[model samples]
Target: MNLHSAAPRSDDRDGYLVSRRQAWFAFAMTFALMLFDYIDRQVIVSLFPHLKAAWGLSDMQLGSLVSIISIVVAAGGLPVALMADRVSRVKSIFVMATVWSLATISCMFARNFGQLFAARAIVGLGETGYGSVGGALIASLFPKRLRTTLLGAFFAAASLGSVLGVMLGGVVAAHWGWKAAFGVVGVPGLLLAFLYLLVPDYKTVELAPRVGHARHSVRSFARQIVSTLAGSPTVWWTCLGAALQLVVVSMIWSWLPSYFHRYHGAASDHAGMLAAVIVLCGAVGSVIWGVIADRLAVRRPRNKLVMMAILCTATLLVFVTAFGCTMSANLQFLLIALGGFLMMCTVAPTATVVLNVIHPGVRSTGAAILALFQNLFGLAVGPFVGGLLSDAFGLQVALAVMPAFGLFAALCFLLATRTYESELAKVEHIRLDVATSSTSPMTVSA
Candidate 1:
């Protein structure tokens, strides 16, 4: 039987054309795991004060703890994602989740900075591949038109998870202890890892038969990665643009609770709750911006990248005002929330652009590459730089200045507009060729 006959058509016009029940199930599970992923990652930030006092740590040391995980993730993401593309995404995710969850649990037993840092690095190992693979899975399960909205909502899970992680970490640490907070948050992910095994997944594009020797698969895989990266300039621009925009996001999420505590004279839990509210606004903004971007794409197909540029521009302006001005704390809080909303608007649209331009054969790898840039530039550097600035100039000054990086991000997106349509057309042509080839009968080897 021809595999193309079994595969779902991309052009089916009836609304909700994908496998509705199974896709939603997979999405829910994937989204839940993403939520936990951030929860485990961000919970440490909420405990910074406690850890500082107990360990006699400096601001830079606290920041390094957060940045180290991203450093590891950025380094490991591409290789692990390539492995997922060649092997099984489902099994890969299961192993990844279990490893991270166990790593999170190990944090509770850490006796010092070295132990804790090593445990966090292990957490990074488990998380590095999950996002790219999950994005590919979700992209495959849904129609192309809904890509932005679906992925926007999917990525928004990070914000929602961060909110819960910070909020709960503060509350738990205040009452029980910082170590207990790690255990409480880490256990649920273990349960979710088990449940995730039941979610449906499609075979990767590389699994489709090609006119190539099995022994040459490794070389072929590396060639595909190189070709995908070289052919799609949009991927390069989008990744860099998203990374630049995320500098503001990483700084805010990493340091906002501390800002509330030191600047506003709020308690640890109070600061965390307030920061979580701001983060929640970003979550809502992601979904709203996704819908708006989709509507704009419908009206003007060329405006997708343009919309991202506009959003990043707005993010730069809003965040700078929110942080740079010395308004009443109430007004600052409101402006910060507003800035978060605008900042988050870039997430879904950028992801949609990446998916649109990359070949399905390397979608996970493409996403992994994007993750590498975003994490390396944004997650790994943003907080550490902010902390260094904080130590030198003060926390408020550091944060106030960070939003300006979004300007560079906006420029990257604007540059991407030039090549977006051309790259998208190329991907569409590749898909058509693949479909045509898939429909042909297989020939027996002589």
Candidate 2:
């Protein structure tokens, strides 16, 4: 029997009418949450110079905190991601939001490395839920045409968060004290925690008919992940590319403030403002790139991923010039902003390409694995690696190293081109086949 709400004719209560405005509002709300999520992650970076002085942190000690925070995300993300697939996304995001917010504010209580490390670890744990579920919900809510554009718009929230975190962290650290930086950036997240409730829960088709069952088990979830990776070359390549991207992205987060202060003689606030400008440029770049990718992909199927490769290469070149070569401080900021813009342009395309190639059932899991690599390797090691290099060489030399990493990311995406094109073709073919099968059926009589 046809339910009245889902009745054959109307696009209403039974049928689930989703307007473009609703889709965008959802994107904006989640985008704001994601913005804060990132603020908590990198707020420490802007505070790093001060935090180091106050906490008596050696480069190695500071590196350890960054490393452990990323490592925990790497180690814990998959397990938690698996859990996300099996639970209420709403509950997971809510709980994770609370955990990270509290953990962030708890930084105010840290008088030692152990306290800070523990707080960072908890923040990582909370981030796992946010990153995994947020993308999945966005994908399910938007139509195919709008998915990448919307995701790009949402992902730009990271830049906004980055801007706020760095600028605020610096301002707060300089004026109030480093501890207050944590509290100021962190406390707002608690308020956003309640906003998570207003967003609609994403609807998904169960893998098997529910049959009144408990959700997926650890063993089963593991199998699904294995199967997903095994079946998906796009996942593999995207992960590889994202890992490299993370390294550079991570390096910037972990070290740029220090670089500016040490080299350009900028104060904390000035350095933080520069970082914020770069991130703000990144936010704008991401939205523009999404629009470009969407418009181009409509004609050329592989344009989205191709654009990612090209932009990464361009970013690598600009970043090398910005950091590796000598220029006036103003010129340096302008070049760096351009690089940030190019690098950020890839986020939407990167996410869109990954989403397009995966089965819907495991989108969260796939996104989880992507996050796992990003945090585990890219974010996990980026800051520490930059620091370690800074300790070994000079800060200038350490700052110069990440462009090479960006180059590597460009290569990974370029290498994956054949696989990406093939898989996307398959996805499109399957979609066309399904549409054809549905429309061409039921010739009943002779």
Top candidate on TM-score is: 1
Predictions: Cα RMSD each: 4.8, 7.1
Candidate 2, pairs of clashing residues:
5-14
Residue-by-residue lDDT tens digits, candidate 2, 363-411: 6777877777777867777788878888889777876776687777777
Under the 3 Å rule for N, CA and C atoms, how many clashes does model 2 have?
A: 1
Clashing pairs in 1: none
Clashes found in each candidate (C-alpha, N, C closer than 3 A): 0, 1
- Provide the overall lDDT of each model, using Cα atoms, as 2-decimal numbers: 0.83, 0.73
Residue 208 of candidate 2: its Cα lDDT? Answer: 34
Model 1 agreement with the true structure over 353-413: per-residue lDDT tens digits: 8878887777888888889888999888888999999999999999889988988998999
